[model samples]
Target: MWKSGAACSATRVGVATIITTVFGMALADALIKQSSTAMTLWQIYVLRSALVLPILLVMARGRMNTGRYGWIALRSLALVLMYLGIYAAIPWLELSVVAAALYTSPLFIAGLSAIVLREPITSRHWLGILIGFAGVLLIVRPAASGFKPLALVPVGAAFLYAVAAVITRAKCSDMPTRALAVWLNLSLLVTGLAASLYLSRTGVGAGFDYPFLFGAWRPMSGRDGWVIVVLACLMIGISLGLARAYQSPRPQVIATFDYSFLIFATFWGFVFFGDIPDRLTLLGMGLIMLAGVIVLTAGTPEPTRLEKAKVARDQPLVPCRVKTRTRPQRTDTSPSNR
Candidate 1:
């Protein structure tokens, strides 16, 4: 029973929020890919993390004490691994391809939930998982003569992301959102610093000229520094928009719109890096997007026995009664006797 005007207004807001979030994320990825050419991946991570910390702290203010340190650290480590895999892949793989592969996290989440949470797997969920992996194979195309093993990197990233998501749900469910954000950025900063220092000592190796991975800590160009700064701000904006979108009354509706990230990624890839997907790859991306939508819309709700019993008890009961026929019986008996 939605009012049409209100529904339309909400839909508009949701669409705008999703669009902004996806664009922000895509832009951040594009900037990272660009920055990779001039700096090490660790440098980008450290700089971006450094820039984001102040913003996160300002937003979190005094509300950053809600999360348990152990769980937060675990989740942050998972995220660091996830980002490492993804940023490494971006330099070698097309942005759209990497993004499509990363979107497989939803399927991984479903499988992980079944294993770790002992949740039941429905036929529909299984079908979605199968289709999703199939799409991944199409993108990776390991058997194909032109296959690049680097394509698997994003798949690894997706797995880590799924693991982080599972941990968040299972262990950090009560953590304030801002507190979680703070810990995540802090982890990124520490990991980045460690990696950068190690690489600085080892030096960039042959065939690893990509500044984002093996390059030494050097002065960044004015332009690239600004790009990183902008990317950092965009990350914060994207996080906020995502929070708003998912927190909306119609999460399913907003969730569906999240697939737009692939489209935005594709557009940015073309515009920024001139990276284009082949016909087969495009088909694979479409399949992945479809499978993601299916999984997202097919929510897995596990009702406990107590909840089920409560529902049953809440239902109205119908009464049944037996009618007596003593008067009719007596009349028939008297007639028979006479």
Candidate 2:
């Protein structure tokens, strides 16, 4: 009874943590969208990463997994690319649209699992993937009057994010969550520094005036600086929340709540940017969320052959009895004594 109660409490904590994670991520994106108007993406990345590093370092102390450094680096690079794509698209696209597009990662994950992880892909997963892509089409509205090539940016981000997630599960599953967070932020810092150097040397073109993507570094306003600080804090919260949520014994339970990020993203979009989704956009968002929920709640993956072997090896051995001709001799002896 006590064990059951503890499990229930842990589940509740995991759910709450995941919900908070969604909100924190949405808020961070909103803050980035707001601040991007005044600062370069590289600058924001560099500053926020720099600010968040010390905190993650302290948290990750004694938790680092050096054995999986290669996988960690791969995952971090994928994450950096994901961020670069989404941040570039955010300025040109509506917040909700970018978010909905990015949320397609679950579909990508499903497909990738089949290819890379050798996980069976059920028909339901395929249906979910189709519906999810249909949602992307609705959002992108390709060849329609409202189509924008920039809409593809978030899709790219989603693909990279899916790759990162797959690597997390497949290669770095044993690594501590704090170690993953530390390496992710560190990678962001390195990417930011590299981008800043390249941009500083090349200079911004006249046609690309958006400081967030193309513009070179300049003095950040006090307001923008504060916003970056808030963004950094939000990133920390997001990292911790996601790490905890996914690391839970029953990750599917926590993952089902991840779709709420779209809701929060939509809310923040309207409140901060005064951007409202039209019927088509809303439809797309709904379909994407539904597909994500379906995919996440379908079922957990079965243990791999290696994992099954490991489980079997860890189990205690039981002694076996042998029946032999001696049993008959003992019975005969007992009968004579009687």
Q: Write the per-residue lDDT of candidate 2 for residues 7-109, one digit (tens) a residue.
A: 7788889999999999989888888888776888888889999999999999889887568678888899999999999999988888899999999999999
> Which stretches in model 2 have alpha-carbon errors above 4 Å?
204-207, 300-338
List the global CA lDDT of all models: 0.84, 0.87
TM-score of structure candidate 2: 0.88
Error of 1 at 100 (Å): 0.5
Give the per-residue lDDT digits (tens) of candidate 1, residues 1-338. 55877877777798789978998898888888877767777777788889999989998899887737887888989988998899989888889999999999989988999999987777778878888888999889999998999999999999999999999899997777777887888888888898777776766443575666777776888998898889788878876787767666677678778888999999999999888888888888888888877887785667889979997999899786888777544455577688
Clashing pairs in 2: none
The pairs that clash in candidate 1 are 39-211, 39-212, 40-211, 40-212, 41-212, 41-213
Q: What is the lDDT of residue 275 in candidate 1?
A: 88
> What lDDT, from 0 to 1, does candidate 2 have?
0.87
TM-score attained by model 1? 0.85
